[model samples]
Target: MGSVFHGDITVGYEDEGSGEALVLVHGHPFDRSMWHPQTEHFSRAGWRVIAPDLRGYGDSTAVPGTTPLAAFARDLAGLLDHLGIERCVLGGLSMGGQIVMECYRLFPERIRGLVFADTFASAETADGKAARYAMAERLLREGMDGYAHEVLAKMISPATIAARPDVAAHVLRMMTATPPEGAAAALRGRAERPDYTGLLSRVTVPALVVVGAEDAYTPVGDALDIHERVPDSRLTVIEQAAHMPNLEQPDTFNAALGAFLDALP
Candidate 1:
């Protein structure tokens, strides 16, 4: 475990190996542990893997109010600064993917490549915004216990839940353990995120857009849309996996990710 202070927030992260940097960000309601497979694989393959628990998740400090995507992006940049990494191949899954895009928007010079997995670039629709706010309220009113149980299948596929009990348990554990206040705050802040569709077009670095064939959240169409918009990008759809392919099907996800990293300039 590694720690870096950003104001009152203490960012907790996993830093391993010793080579070119590969910084990964986990999704909402999940800690840095979600990237365990990637961290282990990439680090062994001669890359310094850095996976951080975003504000309010894992071992990091949780801010009570809304935490914007830009705040997450800034925290990532600050972490890199603390590590003395001038640039890196930034990758993220789900909400983390959006944060990675935000990083590119804020500091393109600091990014060498991008990996956007199971995420979209569209802004929140009015109905979606309302739903997020409602969910936030519900999270605060109740807690993560009920919500975690309800969303397990959606987070990963029903097939995965049944077939891979270990993966399912890990996913459920992460969601259940998340601080409701932090999750709710992220929900509120994510509600106001701007559209990144246009922003994808201006991406100067190599980009890899990946999705699970069974993904319920961000479908294959979303990945396709991102791939089309990004000037230098490739797309891969992993079969028999859902939103969390990195865990559901680690070998396939790692293979695709490894190939991308190998080809990066």
Candidate 2:
């Protein structure tokens, strides 16, 4: 395990193996541990795998300021620079994917490939950003207990949830334990992020658009759009999974990833 210092803040990161860099960014309410499957596979496959705890999530302590997703991207850039990595493959899941897009926008030269799983190009739609704002307000007002229940119910397909309550419970616990501040800040960032459609054209890197078959949060249509729009991107959907496919169906997710990475020239 290795780390990179971002000023007074010690961004807790694990840099393992020795080949092209592959950075993994976890989603909202998730710590670096969320990438356990990815970390193990990528590192052992000879890629220098880098996984960091987003602000306030894991051991990497949060600072006293606005922790918007854009700031999260900057934090990623700082981490890469701190570790002396010039160019690498960047992948993000859910809110983490937004951070990766921001990273691509800010530092296009440093990206070799893109993987956006269960993420959105925009958090708002015809109803405007109210839905996003309301979600944050609900989390702040109702706290994690209510938020956890609501999200857990929506995270997986009803069939999957019924078949494996224990797994569902574990997943719920993971989100519930996240400090409300970080979760709320992430929601706010989603409602406020600029539209990423314009930037996709300039992003010629090989890309993967992964979505869950039952992901009601981020529509499958959006992932299809990503596949069609990104010059060299492909879309793969995992069945019996919802928003967090990597958690609910890790084997399927890992297999897709393994095939994709293996195919990369």
Candidate 3:
């Protein structure tokens, strides 16, 4: 684990292997450890993998209050600048995917390709915004343990929880261990996310849209929408997996990602 300071924030990251860069962002309520499988697999496949724990998660500095999506994007851009990487294949899952879209919005020239996994391209609905705000208040009031237990099944499928105890435990650990202040800040920021449908249509780089067939959060339909909107993109849906397919079915997810990376220019 290496870290780079961005003013008051210390971004904790993993930098491994060599060759073209592939920067993977972890989703909300989770840390960089969530991408351990991908880091090992892709780094061995001759790619430099950079996975970072967002400001409020993992070993990074925690800041109370809102952490806008653009803040996350700027942190990543700053990390790349520190590493002297001008470009990379940027990818993310869930809220991380939305952050990647914001990255593209701010720094298109720094991206060689795009990967959107188990995520959506729409803005938060009025109902979603309300729920997010409510959840933020709940996190601040009650802390993350209760929310982690409640959302564990939703984050991964029931089948996954039953069949893959290890993945289930890991996912639960990430959520429960997350700081309430940080998680609540992220929730507040996410509540105001803008629609990325128009932005997707303008993406010129080759793109990969992946989702779990059983993902209840984003669903396969969300991936399909992204694939259709992105002029040059590929879509892959992993079976027997849910929102966290990369952990629940790492082999299948890695195969799709590997193929996409190999095909990229």
Residue 251 error, candidate 3, Å? 0.4
Where model 1 places Cα greater than 4 Å from the true spot, the runs are none
Give lDDT tens digits, candidate 2, residues 23-88: 989887777877777788778888888999887666676553346667888888899888889998
Residue 158 displacement in candidate 3 (angstroms): 1.5
Give one digit per residue, the lDDT tens place, for model 1 in 1-265.
7999986799999999999999999998999999999999999999999999999999999888898999999899889999999999999999999999999999999999999999999999999999999999999999999999998998899999889999999999999999998999999989999899999999989999999999989999999999999999999999999899999999999999999999998
TM-score of decoy 2:
0.90
What would you estimate as the lDDT of candidate 1? Answer: 0.94
TM-score versus the correct structure, for each prediction:
0.99, 0.90, 0.99
Whole-structure CA lDDT of model 3: 0.94
lDDT of 3 by residue, 25-141 (tens): 999899999999999999999999999999999989888999999999999999999999999999999999999999999999999999999999999999999999999999999
- Native-structure RMSD, model 3: 0.7
- Residue 215 CA displacement from its true place in model 1, Å: 0.6
The best-first sequence of candidates by TM-score reads 1, 3, 2
